[model samples]
Structure formats: C-alpha cells, structure tokens
Target: MTTPPDWSKEEKAVQAVQMAFDLSNDIQRAFRVSAALQDMSTSDMVRKVLQLPYQKNRARPRLTITLKDEDFELLAEKYGLDPLDRATIRHRVSEDLRAFAGNYLTES
Candidate 1:
C-alpha cells in the first residue's frame, strides 16, 4: 500500500493529488458507484472511506488461509457465517481464531 501524503496546515492546499492505484476493476466499479450514490467526488469519497477503519483504531492486514470445502462449511456453520459471502467468512474466521488464541493463551 502507498503511504498517504501528510495533510497538515503547513502543507500547501492542493486541490488534488494524483496517485496510481493497482486495484481490481470490480473494486474500481464499486468505488465509482458508491461515489455516485453519495453525490461526492470519487477521490474525496475514497479518501473519506479509507480513513474510516483507521479512525476506528482498527488495523487492516492481509491474511490467507486454505481449507477444504467441507471444513469451510463446518466452520461457517459453527461461526454463523454465510457461506455465500467470502467477506463474512473471513471476518467470522478471524474473530473465532482470535478468540480461540486468547482463550488458549489464558489457559496456558
């Protein structure tokens, strides 16, 4: 990920900063739709939206996991995750895994 430019009072008030992003077409389309729906410039919308998780004091990191279909289904059911939604699956699994790790650490 690219580092965001500093937005300080001392910095010059530039109308916009151009940066190239290597995002998937689907993501680009989604951002465009969201910007249109909110009646805002795409750049402004993207900046505001991207700041949300940071504002919440949440860390955004990438993780990859491989599981058999049956295993995934079982975990999804146990965690009340929707199998059709990959985002929900990932969120549920991350939450459950973190909880498990915490419990294990405490018990140890």
Candidate 2:
C-alpha cells in the first residue's frame, strides 16, 4: 500500500487564518507545552479552544506604542521578554492585555 502525500505547505496555510488570543499565564504555559508536543502553533491551539471556523478570515489590526529606551527596557525586564525585538515585545504585551481583559470581563 502506498501512503498518501502530505498537503502542500500553501494548502495547509490557507486552511486557517492566523490571529492572536490570550489565555491565563498558567493556561498559556500549558497550551505552549501541548502545542510543542503536537508541533503546532499556539494560534492554532487557540482556534481549537474558541471553536472558530477553520477557513474564516478575520481582520486583525495593528497597534503601536512608543516608549523611551529606558522605559522599554524596564517593561521588557518586568515582562521577562527580550527588549531588542519589537515583534516579540508587541506580542507579549498583546497577550498580557488580552489576559487582563478576560479577567476584567469575568469579574465585572
């Protein structure tokens, strides 16, 4: 018997849209471990958790924040993130804000 061929990379990529979502720190860590084990992205895991349609496209807006070099370094240290990479810093801040929003909604 012959094994089927794997999907093309483009085919796989087009099956889902990439977007960001937040989990609690503990939950985020757990999902990170699970995603690593499965060799999947955390965004895909979040899609599973939210039961979003696999092929749907959602608008994702960008946010910009400006900070002094010293202030940026302080935030990086506080969040335990790398200060040199803007994308990583933004992603970390987005995750933290999402978690905060979730908590706020739950408590209100």
Best by TM-score: 2
Q: Taking the candidates one at a time, how many backbone clashes does each contain? A: 0, 0
lDDT of 1 by residue, 1-108 (tens): 999876874365565456889999999999888865665556656777877322222133334578877877887787777666667787778887788869756553
Query: Residue 82 in candidate 2 has what lDDT?
Result: 77
Among all windows of ten consecutive residues in candidate 1, which has the lowest summed lDDT?
52-61
TM-score computed on alpha carbons, candidate 1: 0.33
Candidate 1 lDDT? 0.69
lDDT values, one for every candidate: 0.69, 0.69
Q: How many clashes would you count in candidate 2?
A: 0
> What lDDT would candidate 2 get against the real structure?
0.69
